[model samples]
Target: MNQLEQLKKYTKVVIDSGDIENITHYTPYDATTNPSLVLKAIQMKKYEYLLQKSINYAKKKGGLKNQIVTNATDKIIVSIGAEILKKIPGVVSSEVDSRLSFNTEKSIKKAKKLISLYEVEFGIDRSRILIKLASTWECIQAAKKLEQEGIHCNLTLLFSFAQARACAESKVFLISPFVGRISDWYSINYSSNKYRSSLDPGVQSVKKIYEYYKKHDYKTIIMGASFRNIKQVLSLSGCDCLTISPELLSILQAKNKLITKKLFIPKKIYAKPIKKLSHSEFLWLHNQDPMAVEKLSQGIRQFGTDQYLLEEIVTKNM
Candidate 1:
């Protein structure tokens, strides 16, 4: 079997891309998309029709250019996600607005709106749509509300155990703990000597969350995302799911026979008993961890900027 097939025996492999052309080559079970990805896709010559169609639809809706652009961007994301579902048999995650991250009610409202847009406008089912939200306190709260309404969520930008624990506690659908971003932070601040062999801090973060979820029986699926290299990808081989970029997926596919399960069956816990943090503790951890703080804020801003740019394109065209 190819490494992709072998990896599937243990972990669910998800394609982290907006372009549908590459989906067949990697054949990931599921796929994920964000504003940035949508922006990238629409910029391509082949996808120009999608962008034009979105603008036409927006113009017909008879709204302001900004509104048209925002609507168009949302349509583009949903359209891409819907098309991706045609290729991959599993779910496709479409992210919510980063601007709504801190507002629980607004986040929930936007999530439902996105779902409605996908279903009524794009004709995609709710089951196949995992509403993506940042792993913030308000976003978690929003996800909890959405879950009760039978809306699934894919929590993104997750960095710490606290975030994972909170998401699991809320019974949210899935948590995407970013491995590459974590590695980036550690590599910038700390030395490589601090990590175990093949155990970068980012990989360790996902492993910690995986072990915790399994050990404690949290059904919230752990999907490792934002991998920097094949090594980081391989380190979480048996995770519930890993959303990998096409580049790394290709690398994994190339070395078909070399893949093996590295993370499976919860091992003996060696760390001291650490109580799941209260909201206060969670805040403390957030404040204490500069990397997490900076990255979380930066991630939100970046997504927000992409969203703004997407709106701009729509506005200009309309």
Candidate 2:
């Protein structure tokens, strides 16, 4: 078997793309999308019809220009997600608007609306959708409420242990700790060559979180995301899940190699139960980690910008 097949024996592989066309070839168990990916996918000619269809749906709703654009963008995202769900047997994570990230109520509202679109309009089951949210305190809280409503969540842009700890405490369905982005930060600030596979800061971050969850027996799933290379993917061979890009997925599919499990749950455990992170404690610990602070803020802004760009596309079609 190729490396992709080898890795799938342990880790649940997820396709990280809004372009559902590539999803069939990879046959990932799950699929994930964000604002940036949705924007990129909409620009492609093949997905142009989805954009046009969404614009028409928004017009029919008869809202103001800005509201119409927002409506259309959400429709487009859900349309793409619906198409992806047909290809993969597992769930598809459709993100809430990043602009709503800091507002708990609005975040919850948007997530519900997205879920409604998938269930009512697309005729998809709520079970196959994971509402993707930022790891903000507000967003995490928003997820907590949504989870009660039977809306499972996938928290993105998670960087620090604080973020991971909070998600585990909330019993979130899944948390995506970016593997490449962490390495990107350290590469710019420190020596790049010093990190590789197991030693890579990005790889280490996921390993640390995975061990913590296993040791404590937390049920929140750890899905490693944003890999820059196959090495990082191989390093996380035994992760609960790994959302990978098409570029790296194809590389793994082409190369036949043996992949050994890197992460494992210890057979024995003996430890005192640790207290959960309070909102204040979560903020303090996350703030103490400079990389987490900068990256989380950067990720939100980037997603927000891409969302604006997607809205602009909808406006042109309107």
Best by lDDT: 2
TM-score of each: 0.93, 0.98
Candidate 2: tens digits of C-alpha lDDT, residues 227-295 = 998899999999999999999999999999788999999776636678889989999999999999999
Q: What are the Cα lDDT values of the candidates?
A: 0.85, 0.93
Runs off by more than 4 Å, candidate 1: 192-197, 267-278
Clashes of each: 1, 0
Question: Whose TM-score is greatest here?
Answer: 2
What digit string (tens of lDDT, one per residue) describes model 1 on residues 129-219? 9999999999998999999999999999888777888898889999998888888888778874545537688898888888877777678
Give the runs in model 2 whose Cα sits over 4 Å from its true position. Answer: 192-194, 270-272
Quote the positional error of residue 137 for candidate 1 in Å: 0.6
Pairs that collide, model 2: none
Local lDDT at 182 for model 1: 81
